[model samples]
Target: MAARMKRRDFIRRTALVGAGLLILRDPKSAWSYQANNRLNIAAIGAGGQGGGLVNIFAGMGENIVALCDVDDRRAAETYKRFPNAKRYKDFRRMLDELANSIDAVTVATPDHTHAVASIAAMKLGKHVYCEKPLTWCIGEARAMRKAAIEHKVITQMGNQGTASDGLRQGVEIVRAGVLGQVREVHVWSNRPVWPQGVDRPKDTPPIPPDLDWDLWLGPAPYRPYHPAYLPFVWRGWCDFGTGALGDMGCHTLNLPVMALKLHRAIAEGKTVVVEAEHSGCNGESYPKWSIVRYHFPARAGMAPLTLVWYDGGKKPPQEVLSLIPGEVPGSGCLIVGEKGMLYAPGDYATRWQLLPADQFRDFRPPAPFLPRSPGHHREWVLACKGENITPMSNFVDYAAYLTEIVLLGNLAIRLGGRIEWDAATARVRGRPEAEPLVHRPYRKGWTL
Candidate 1:
């Protein structure tokens, strides 16, 4: 027999055990700050990216209240993962049924559906985390931004790379003038592969038993069923997806855009557009070699700089590569400044490196002074629970990012000429003919 422990000692030991449990189970505890509460999360488009996000939130102890998708096969898979979660083929129905139960929503849908689904969530006061490219068109991006602000709901864009500690650290270093006054930026990507520049499908394949064909094409034009358009091959098409610029431009070009805060520097009421050459794409609606050019306003104590976006799978010229070693580091950025240059890998997750052999061969980055951020989904949930602003690719940032890149590529696609863009008015200045392309009218039953 052993003597009974005193009440105070027992209480202290119990608390210590509880603390250990919290430390091991809750990764958010590792951070100095977190929302005092958990978020009730719902996912729209329960497929690849969306599924990954759901798993992260669920692991963090958030209630997965809803799962939405158009494809039956996709929905069935999602249902199996979180059987208790309410499932719906249409997002609108999910929002209607679970509006009161959901505190936030993660939207991972095709470019065409991003705006509609996200706008709906925001209007209902749900914090929204939408996938990259933001929207199918520049107009939709603008509208989504407006809706998010109007509803006073927290919002994030699903550019996961932004959440990486490496990304933010890189941004701070560049902003600190470690790389000097920057001017030109070169961003490249390998994308734009699929059924581009080809004749419309002449054969109508039988609709699969598990797919809701009409629902998948919602908002986008109604077309006969085709296997080429299904599964993951939609990226290359015009009506359903945003081509390569829309697909990879947001992710590849994000660093330069945010590091410089080019969006914030641009005049709120003014728009700048420059004429550019376009080719490539093998006849797809978007060009394979479309070079996007934008004149960004001066900021961070530097003069105005021209930002050029390269797509159609083209590599930067040798002159640009000369500043860096080993062939421009493949998919990365070349930032040429007055004093020095900076080179960052194209993969947004990679860290930024100073260019040229002469600059600090032995120099080391400053001590890791920043707190290690949790994965993307957790950041949004934590941000939503408190008054803190979610820093990752939120709707506002992604809206500006997508509007510029998507419109740039869209201007390239319009065969008439290199149309001028007005960021302020959200229109194409010198070309009234291009205005129609700026805003796409949705098919019936879709509301913005």
Candidate 2:
């Protein structure tokens, strides 16, 4: 076998090689078994969400040639599913060994590890589909965006709602002025169940034989293995996860960002200013509840809008919930506008209907359209073959959408005040004390 290649060097060559080779090929024909069309895929962080991604992609006829994860046991079952694929504990080693073969990579790791793994993969000229929130901090988010641009790799974030027909139509309706002048929007979810804001767990579990605890911790501080932090419950912790906002805000709260075209309003002071209020553990150790209010000057055609996010089993109110058909708001968003109201109390993939027909009969409910891509995983699988269409949750878009909500909310939770934000620069312009907390430091030997 040939000697392994460094990620940076591999990417530089791959970009020149892959672009020239892929540019002439038709994406529609790339999925077939033709010698020039087969795609080789690799997966990093094959545990909970990562394992699911592997399954989704493996079933899509792509060649899943590598699997990397810190835990052998959790990855064991996933590896068996792709028995022909090579497995490794570290993604860097996997990339080095499989550099020539891997055309794309899926990073389904924790929040803190997202940027590290994604940037490394993107640098190798491998198309990447990283999980939601993209990165733990705003700086990492920016870094990943830059790396993706520099490497010219197709990238997607795991905010699956973006691929949903309901969300697309909802956004279309909002853009078309059907929900005229959306002034106040409420986006929410049931999250932070991993027990944030509470003290660390008392019982430390011994590292399992099939697990590499140190590697799993990666850039996080040295903490003994605990059951509470593993097997899919890390969403609430500050160290490893990004709480509810980081967990679901990108999915649930994405509607307003897309519908209002908030990105275009940066020069007009029409930016996201989050007012975070009351954060602490619920029953278990979890910063389970946060009421974040996002104020935005309306995009040119609409009125100023205030977007509120509620998570951790918290409901907006009976009056607000009553606006929709069902008593339970569950895990979705409510858009309140001047002429009418629309309540979609669930994921965009599923049922999301406009409230009471009596409100606006002429207002035909928008068509619920499925995405052109096949789910989130396959979207990236297909994108690697020079197809420009990625999951609606592309990192450049999602990182901008998510980091603003999660990091700014975190600043409010930390500073205990509503800080005004300058979206152009992504900083709190008016407050001096709140400026330093904009980004957090990694433990060591790790960088955004």
Candidate 3:
């Protein structure tokens, strides 16, 4: 009888494939998870990066139950490909009607809408995979973390490198103290790849018929429809996006945060200091170039350190560059420690090298401690089915704080002054002017 019961359980675990999508059966369904029998996935902002994400999930054999986007022209291909999937222009309506059917949602919307779309899904207990720099502002990042935890939902921020073996290994190495007291970190990006330091266009362009301009401007203040903010260029605008620091900081800064426990300051009720200097700020968009500094308070036995971020063709000083050999990459991270420096020569912390080769020629890496991921999206998919694995970049554990640290730099940049961040209170010390930036007022129709 025991043997027979075991066989039944094994067969019950078999995945169900419907419409060519896999619905991996689970031992138990948790957190309002409905995908144990049939995984029905939804994509918000289904065009460009959003479209690409839907395609990847589809390739994983997950049913695309719904696709939501504000622009019809941009999402044309996605709608055509997933004709069977219900389509909508507003994500709120999509979540309202299809909440029961969708087991998970992928939020690839522009930076500003990330918090709203993701928080709404989490409130309904649907698993969420949101794009990087989790939200447009620091308040939203905190809210995203709260929603994920309160709902007991599975969450993965879309910094895919969080799953890579190299990144995980790097984190483990740093935690193992192989680098011997990492004191300073420098992360640089070649962003603003679209455009920055430009005034808002004066000409009012016709809102494309396929686009719902109101929906596109969701939480942001009202603005006439303009071509400049559409498709992919929203990263530079103050109202629409979070610029270079928000665009790439989440990816480039992941290693240092995880390894050095940069979140320790906040966790321990400490404040972080941040300041920025930039090239020509026009008050409409981010500067063409900027350098920002973050001072984290010492906590959890780790010494205090400062992280410097450079963007818009900015690179680190030559003295710092001299530590690594050969051609310096366009974007990379450097962690300076008492013993030696560790360099990650890419946007994602997918690869690393112990610098000054001769000094470290005999060094052997510490044994890996962090569990290696089974692909980024797969980790989320598995967790959605109540699998034992959790995504490394899950909101409650990692992404929220990482995003908070990243957005703080932008606050300093836009405010053009030093910010004494009171993490415990989530306020700028003696800077009432930053209230608008910290806690943004939503339009009447929107809510986070």
Winner by TM-score: 3
- Least accurate stretch of 10 residues (summed lDDT) in model 3? 1-10
Each candidate structure's TM-score, on Cα atoms with residue i matched to residue i, is: 0.85, 0.85, 0.92
Error of 1 at 64 (Å): 1.1
Task: Please report how far candidate 2 places residue 41 from its true position, in Å.
Answer: 1.0
Tens-digit lDDT string for candidate 3 (141-209): 899988886777778899999889998878777777777887799999989798899998999978888
- Name model 3 segments beyond 4 Å from true: 1-36
lDDT of 1 by residue, 206-231 (tens): 99997888878889888898988866
Better of 1 and 2 by lDDT: 2
lDDT of 3 at 147: 85
Count of clashing pairs, candidate 2: 5
Model 2 per-residue lDDT tens digits across residues 309-419: 787677787778777764674687788877676677674533466656676656675453324446766666555554444445666544445555556676666566677
Residue pairs whose backbone atoms clash in candidate 2: 165-369, 195-285, 195-286, 196-286, 196-287
